[model samples]
Target chain A: MSLLEVRNLKHKFRDGTEALRGVSFKVNSGDFIILAGKNGSGKTVLIRHLNGLYIPSEGEIFFEGKPIHKQIKWVRQNIGMVFQDADSQIVSQTVWNDTAFGPENLRLPKADIEKRVSNALLAVGMMELKDHSPHNLSGGEKRKLAIAGILAMDPRIIILDEPFTNLDYTGIIDILGQIVKLHKSGHTIICVTHEIEKVLYHSNRLIIMDRGLIAEDTLPEKGIFNTHKYGITPPMEEREGIEIVRDMTWLK
Target chain B: MAEITVFHFQAGNTLIYRLNTKLKLLLLLIYSFSIYQLSLKGVLFLSAFIFIAVSGTLTKPAGLIRQMKGFIFILILIVAASMTSVTGDPLFTGLPFPTREGLLSGMLAGWRFVMIIILGLIFTTTTRPNQIHAAVGEILKPFPLVNESAIAARMSLTIMFIPILMDMLNEIREARKARYIEGSRNPVKNISTITVPLISGVILRAGETSMAMESRLYSGALPGTKQAVQRKEYLLFAACLVPVVPAFLL
Candidate 1:
């Protein structure tokens, strides 16, 4: 059995608009799925459903062969989501406070919470600013703090929506490396982005969404064609002088 | 982004900075309500002491005065009004409006308010918001019929989001400027454009905050992390009272 399976998921907003028509997919352990789509293409809406943030209008989602709705708390505990907007996801004052929020919510022991928060901040290279206020952080720092907040929860499946948004070049490299590291460390990841080229070489599978439907679900090599048709920019062809490095690794 | 440090926390590791947050929070509440009892001279002494000691966390005296110039302006207005309205012995030979007693009274009242504000600055600059949040939870635990953790969580978030909302408003202003629609002769029209977007954005932010909280498994109560009050907290509390009690007595 697959780790997570979505069956014909559908959702309609109160404004008479369907955000997700009928989407289905299965995610296995250690799969790094890159969800790519244009604006208003239901990529975000679909990922939100995976973590039980939104109830599907008509369909069932299962985790480990059990219905998600029956045990959404478990689903949420297992699937951590980093939102597209870093500012929106930030609900705490300090870096350490925000990072500890997830573990604290689980009512873990004080020692456990502290160790988890410290490790998470260390993982994201934010331990130096542990006591600093979250609002004063730069865009890239805020993004990293958001990721650390989810990391403290130690979820098995991590979902990132436009994680590269508003990041500088170094920030992009740093975050992409972190995502790849998470995948290599046995955490399943689903990263949604329009900037496919930055993450294409790292992701194993590609899932494209268009008009609230899964336009294509295939390997990254084959799905490059599907991205362009769905209004996403395909990875640039190797320049005349520069060579593509297929064996490039982003570890550490 | 604008960075205002009037009441914002600054990280430090000085001896005073290491004071327990519970001690600072308790002192803050006590001084806030009891400032009127302190003599004007005592208030002045306390303010000067805070200015000198908190140089590590807060700006210098001159910088603080500059940042609080508007407040000083209000104080001047109050003194001027008292001089003109009250009947007292004149300070100058020919200036009957400038009375010494009215000036003293005005200064006394104004300094009371200023002293409380300065104490608040001291409290915030030394203590982290999370520390204050936890302290508030500890303080509210004794009271019945109150969800201490929930209220503490709300209060902390409210304090932290002030700068964020300010940033959002600044973004809206910049966006307006970029579109070249920021300059309207009609004050109402100009204010409306900013106000409409700000209110809507705040509403959207409120929704987002709730979803974020929910996603993190927040179940109407924060996790318990309270520890035993230390001997140093008690010592600090007593050390603070020793100065203030004598200030009121003498």
Candidate 2:
């Protein structure tokens, strides 16, 4: 069974802007899916609906065969979102407190909260600086801290919106390593990006959206070549004279 | 700017650091109120005691003095204004300045102001910002209409944002200098260039912050396990009240 199902979902803003028109998709458990599109292509709007941030103007969304609206909180608890701006996502003074913010909202016990926070920080290699101020961290460290905050919630699905935006090359590499690690740990990953070149090699499947509808949904090799038509840049290696080699032997 | 440590909390094992945050908050409030009621002598005694007590916990004693540089100018102004109006025996009997009553009154008033600032520095330096939120939440829990957790969270974010906004202002000032706009004589144009971007940045950041909080499922309060105040904390609270008792009697 699919973990999440969206059926002909549509959304319209109060200002008469049609952001999403009859979008539909299904996400299975343990799948690493990339949602790609250009600016104003409804990629953000579509993911926002999955977590109930925006109500659909029409159609339905289901989680585990049940309607999402009936259990909005549960949907939110299961789907953790890491926003683009790292600084804005930090709502607490210290790293530990900010990471614990999600679990605390769930009203867990003191011991459980501490264990989760410690484990999350350790997973992100931020255990030593747990007591430091989040504002003092570097750009790369801040992004990692944001991911750790979401990890503390222990969600089944992790969504990252423009994770590589405003990051240096080293920062981008750092975040990519973390994302790959999460995918390997059996968390269903859904990353939304207009620049798909950085993450294409890692994603198992690609879903392209254009003008509030799905443009193409297929395997990476086939669908990636069609991304530019919808305003997204395909990977550089796909072009002529750019040799690409990826070993699939390790998977067996 | 480098010397300034706004909202920086020093971790320590001192008596002040170990005390419950709620107790410290109450003590700070009581002490602040008592400052106005106490006589000049009492205020001086309290100021001296606080300085001696908090000195052990401060990492940089000089930083506190550096923060007082702006207030020093106001202190001098108060003394100058008081000297001219006060009537009393003049020093040297011929200089026409330095009246004994004015000198005494000015010193007293200046000391009171300094003492208030010092107490505030001590509170901020020793206590963590999150502890303040927890303390505030615990104190407001009894109010039927109040949502203590949400208010505390807002307070924490506001406090944390101060240093960030200050840094942004500094960056904008530098950017203006880089563009040679800093030397422009027109005040309106210079001010508008900086203010426009700063305000817009703040508004954008505020919207982002709200969305981030909502994504984390922050309804109002931090609903995790609560930490209870210990008996030792109650004892320390009583001990702090001892100093204020004399002010009440007087």
Candidate 3:
């Protein structure tokens, strides 16, 4: 069964600008789906609906056969989202406390919260810096901490929006490694980004949107066409003396 | 760049750092109360002692001193006001300045102000921001009308954002320099260039935080078990209250 299904979804802002125009899609369990588009293409607005952040003006979203709006809390718990700005997402002073904020909100037992926080920090290689304030961390580390905060919630589906923005090369690679790791661990992943070169090789499916509509939805290899037309970078398989290495075996 | 460190909590294994945040807060309250009752000479000596002692423990004592640079002008104004406002037997009759009473009163007031500032610095420097949040939350938990956890979380976020705001200001200044507008004489243009972007950035950040909080299922307050206070914490609290006894007696 599909974990999430959106049918004829449409959203219009209060200012009368249409953000999403009858977008429909299905996300199977444990699938890595990449949503690609240019600025104002409605990539973010669509994912915001998945977590019930925005109510649809038309159509509906279903989580395991039920409408998502009725179960906003459950949808949020199961579908975790890591936003673009790491600093804004981090609300707590220390790394551990920030990671614990989600579980604490769930009112989980202390022992369970502790275990989840430790595991999440360990997964992100941030256990050593758990005591440090999130403000002191580098930009990449802050992004990892944000992901760790989501992982502590033990969500089934993880969504990240423009995770590589304003990051150095090493920072980008670090976040990419975490995304790949999460995908391998059987978490259904949905990432939204205009920059496709770094993450395209790993994502199984690519969905492109343009002018508030889904332009294409297919496998990454077949979805490269008309990408530049929508202001997204098309996949570059090879360049002079340097090849795009899709197999990330070295990262393992 | 290093000035930013003065406002942040410094991690350490010292006795002051290890004390519970609630105990430190109580001690600060008692200390502030006691300062008013103490003799002027005693206040001066105590403030100097704390300034020297805390400076000795810090890795960069200069940072602590640098924090006082902005207050120097205010301190001078306060001293001048006290000196001019009070009249008595002058130290040198030929001079136009006030008498010994004004000098003593100004000195006492200045020392009191410095002492209170030092106490706050000591508290913030030694205690982590989360500890302060937890302490405030715990203290407010008994009140039925308040959402202690939510308030605590907001307080902690505010503390964390201070350094971030400072960093943003520095970045904006540097950007201005890069654009060759740092030396612009027009005050309106100079201020607008920074304030507009800073306010916009803050609003955007706040909106993003609200979305992130909603996605994390943060409704109003986070519910979590509190940490158990040790027997040693009681001892520390009692020790902190010792000075208050003398103040009451005097």
Candidate 4:
């Protein structure tokens, strides 16, 4: 069963610009769906609607069959969104403080907040930078910190918008590895990005959004349109995805 | 306890900085109220405040002076204006501006303003924003209507960001300058462009910060039980009001 359902989602800005036009899609838990679109294609507007960042101008968004509007905060607690800009997502002075933001907002006990913050930082390999000022962090570190902030909330579904932007090869690998880990660990992941190569490697399903509509949705193995080059760079040598873990942690 | 920065508070250990924020807050009120009430005693107290502020400058006098110059100028202006009309007495009233009553009143006003400035600077410079916010949260915990921690956090943010805002303003000014020729002068247009971008930029930055804060779980509440704690500290705080009572009565 789908964990999230968007039925005929439409969003129009106050200036009368229709950013999303009847976009609809769904994903079950543990499914990594890539939302691909060109600039101004309503990728962001559609994702923002899922978390009540912007209410749909029309149609409905459901989290496990429950209407999004009915319980905005509760639904938001289950869905974590990482915006395109790291600067926009990071508000705290320290890295740990920034990571602890979402869980703190959830009014978790102080000790739990601290634990989640540490665990989240550990998950992103940012524990060493916990005390550093977020503004002083490098671009990749800031991205990881942003993800860590969401992870601290322990959201079941993580939505990332252009997660690979401003990242180098190593940074890209680090983040993608974490995304795969998150998906494998039972979290539904919906990422909006045009970087088809990374999406193809990391995502089980692909949902291409064009002008706020789901232009194409298919499994990675289906080879829709033979856009292999457009998809993610396949692993250098696949060992059932075990090499990624070994390479990342240097485990036997 | 004070940091090297003029208005920025230091977080590390220091006896004066470590004193209860509520106590410092009370001292500020008492200090201001005493100066507001005019008598020989009040004048002496105000003079002592000036001396302390002046002595503080010995370590980095220029910083303190630079911080005070704007307020000093305004105070000087107020005193000068009042001096002109202090006609009942001949003390410092020889100029067209000075009168006996106006001179006395202006001097008192000037002294009061200075005292308030010095005390305020000391508190702000010595206290960290986090501590201030935490103290505010602790103090306001009693009132059901207020979320003290959030208020404290916001207070900290305002304290921390004011300088950042000022820096952004300076950047905006510099940007405006670069747009124009070296010797050309168009203050009105220059100010328009400068102010417009500064306001917009600050607003946008503020919106982003608020969103970030909101996303992190800053529901703007003090992060503890709403149940009121024992009233001992509050009682002591209220008791600190004794000094101000006499001033107000007088």
Candidate 5:
């Protein structure tokens, strides 16, 4: 049975702008889903609904067998979201305080909060910088700390919105490796991004949105995400490119 | 406030900054009490109070005094109001105004007001809001009732916003000044002219801040580690109260 499900979900902004128009999808436990789209495609809007940050104007979201609206806190406790901007996500002055934020909310005892915070920090390899202020952290470290903040929450499903937006080459590889480990740990994951070139291979399911609607939903395969469909320039079609090699390995 | 904030806080050192915020706030309480007692000494004590405030870490006391210049005008008006014909003696020796005793008392009241203002300026410049919030949580921790972390978080954010809001107000003023907004003194017209833009700016900034906070997952639980030194710090805070009590009692 699917661990999480969304059916015909829709959202409209207060300004009378329709941001998401009747999107639908589902993921069983341990499934890796990639939500893709162009700018203003409602990808972030859709992911936000999964975490109950925004309620759908239409359709239903189910966690396990329960509807999302009926169990908002329960849903949040299970689904962790990592937003695009690293700076905005951090709430504490110091890295230690930020990591402790999630567990502290849970009202756990001091020892438990300490252990979980330590474990979470260790997971992201940020234990060394625990005393450093979050503002002083490098871009990659900030992103990692943001992820660790969610990991401390111990969510069953982690949804990342444009997680690789500002990362350097090495940072991107490091984060991707962490995401793969998360998947291997039997946690369901959803990664949303417009640039599928980097993360297409890591996902078990691919969802594309266009103009507030789901454009495509499929498995990772060649000829998928073709720029020609969107009326944009196509790739070089270099068969020996790393992208091609990644796609081949991913599909296999 | 911005001028004072820029001058008082050094780039380094947490000795004054690290004490949990609530304790610093309690110190403000002690300072207020001390100032209230000093009112008996009249303007002489008030001048001494200002001297002590200037002696503190604030690098630009003159900037702070300048910020209070507008308030000083208001204080004069208050003193004048108290010295009206029904209440106090007038220095001008008018038929319908101030008794000799009332005029003297009004002057003393104004002096007390200045002392209070300077004390506030000192406290506001010296303390960070986060420490205060944490101190409040520490004080309440024994009960195990409220969510200390959330309270601390809100207090810190609110304190930080005061200076930010002041800057926003100044920006609005500058924008209005560009269009000659200060010509009218009529209250209703002035409010309508200034408030419409201010309210809209506040709403826009508030939405942006909230979105930024939510994106960061601010709704999550508080940190698990209560720094070991917080208890020792609390003792030091209690010690800070010792010096002020005797001063106030005298």
Candidate 6:
């Protein structure tokens, strides 16, 4: 069974705008997916549903063969989401407190929460800054704290929405390295970004959405060239004419 | 309050940092209440003692006091307002400037205010916001008709957002400067030009924050944290009042 299965998911805003028309996909364990599309392409809407952040107006989301809503708490705990804007996602004053938010809300024991928070901070290389105010952190550090907050919940699958937005080149590289490390450590990653050139190589598969529907879902190299047709500037053109998927990274 | 970093938590391993958050909060409330009852000498002695005593734990006292420049201006205003009154005996012949009584009274009031804020700074600086939230929830659990956890969560977020909003306002001002739109001499026009963007930004941020909260499984209830006031915590609490109580009685 797939780790996550979405069938005919549709969402309409209260103002009569259809954000997602009918989207379907399956995420198996250990899949590093890059969900890419142009503006208003339902990429965010789809990921939001997987995390139970939004309820689909129509269709069903099955997590490990169980309906999503029926086990929303489990699904939410399992599918962690790192939002596009890192600042808005910071819910506490201190880094340690922010990392503990999810676990505390989960009502885990005090000892368990502490251990999880420590482990998360350690994973992000932020153990030293754990007690510092979140307000004082650099942009890259804030992004890492957001990831650490999610990691504290110990989710099996992580979803990142526009993770590199507003980041400098160094910030982008810092976050991308963390994401790559998370994937290598066996956490499934579903990342959303128009800036695919930064992380397209790390992704094993690419799912392209357009006009509230999945336009293409295929291997990165096969579907990468077609990104321009869907309004995304192809990474191929941006990488100084580099066509190979393996070389599309800053880590190299 | 706009002096954002002054109130932000700083990492330290002093005695104050190790105190239980709930106990620190209770001590702050108790100490602030006692300040109104303190004589001017008592207030001065207590403030001096605490300032000196907690210097190690306060992390950045000099910076914290430096940001209080705006706050100190208000204190001076209070003193000036007190002096302008005619009820007290004048200190000098020059236009009934400062009355001896007014100066003493104003000094007491100002010191009281500073003592309260300093205590608050110590608490916020040493304690985590989430700890405050959890402590608040635990404290309010016995009250009727109260969503204790929700109130606690709001309190935490409000404290956290103050710095963010200040930063936003600063950025808005900078952007306006960059656009050369800050050339207007009218203060009202200057404020109005920036208010709209700041409000819109806050609204947008609120929407995003709610989404972030939901994604993290915030269900308006915090987990049960261990809040028992230990023996060491009580000793620390008593130790805080050691100098203050003697000053008060004297």
Q: Compute DockQ for each candidate against the true complex.
A: 0.50, 0.39, 0.47, 0.17, 0.12, 0.53
Q: Which stretches of candidate 5 lie over 4 Å from their true place?
A: A168-174, A223-225, A231-252, B1-22, B32-131, B137-153, B160-250
Q: What is the lDDT of residue A233 in candidate 4?
A: 34
Model 6: lDDT of residue A190: 97
Where is model 2 chain B poorest over a 10-residue stretch in terms of lDDT? B1-10
lDDT of 4 at B164: 51
Descending-TM-score candidate ranking: 6, 1, 3, 2, 4, 5
lDDT of 4 by residue, A140-176 (tens): 8888898899999888999998989988877787778
Q: Rank the candidates by DockQ, best first.
A: 6, 1, 3, 2, 4, 5
Kindly list the per-residue Cα lDDT of model 4 for residues B35-85, writing each as its tens digit. 776585646645564465446433444565474453555898889978875
Runs off by more than 4 Å, candidate 2? A237-252, B1-5, B8-10, B36-54, B60-121, B181-195, B224-250
By TM-score, the best candidate is 6
Classified by CAPRI criteria, candidate 4 counts as incorrect
Which one is best on DockQ? 6
Question: Ten residues in a row with the worst lDDT in model 6 chain B?
Answer: B1-10
Worst 10-residue stretch by lDDT in candidate 4 chain A? A243-252
Choose 1 or 2, whichever is better by TM-score: 1
lDDT of 4 at B178: 88
Q: Compose the digit string of candidate 2's lDDT tens values, residues A1-252.
A: 899999999999999899999998899999888898899999888988888888999999999989989997788888999988888898876789889988888878879989999999999999998877787788889999999999998989999988888888888888888988999998999999876767777788899999999999899888866776888764545337675533311121
Q: In candidate 1, what are the lDDT values of residues B1-250, reduced to their tens digit? A: 2354445566667656777777777777776665777777677666665666667555444454454443665777777777776668988888877788888887777777677767776776677777777888998999999999889888777766665666667688789899888887888988888889989999998888778778888887775455466898688678766666656664
Q: Could you give the interface RMSD of candidate 1 in angstroms? A: 1.9
lDDT tens string, model 6, B1-250?
Answer: 1235866777778988888888889888878888888887777778777788568787678887675554676788777777776356788776566788888777777778888878877887887776787799989999999999889888888877766876777788789999898898987988788999999999999999999999899987665454777998999888887876787786
The regions of model 1 sitting more than 4 angstroms off are A237-252, B1-8, B37-42, B56-114, B172-194, B246-250
Each model's TM-score? 0.85, 0.82, 0.84, 0.68, 0.65, 0.86
Return whichever of 2 and 4 wins on TM-score: 2
Q: Model 5's lDDT to the true fold? A: 0.68
Docking class of 5: incorrect
Candidate 2 local lDDT, residue A238: 36
Q: Compared with the true structure, what per-residue lDDT tens digits does model 5 show for residues A7-65?
A: 88989899999998888878889888878777788888888888888878889999998
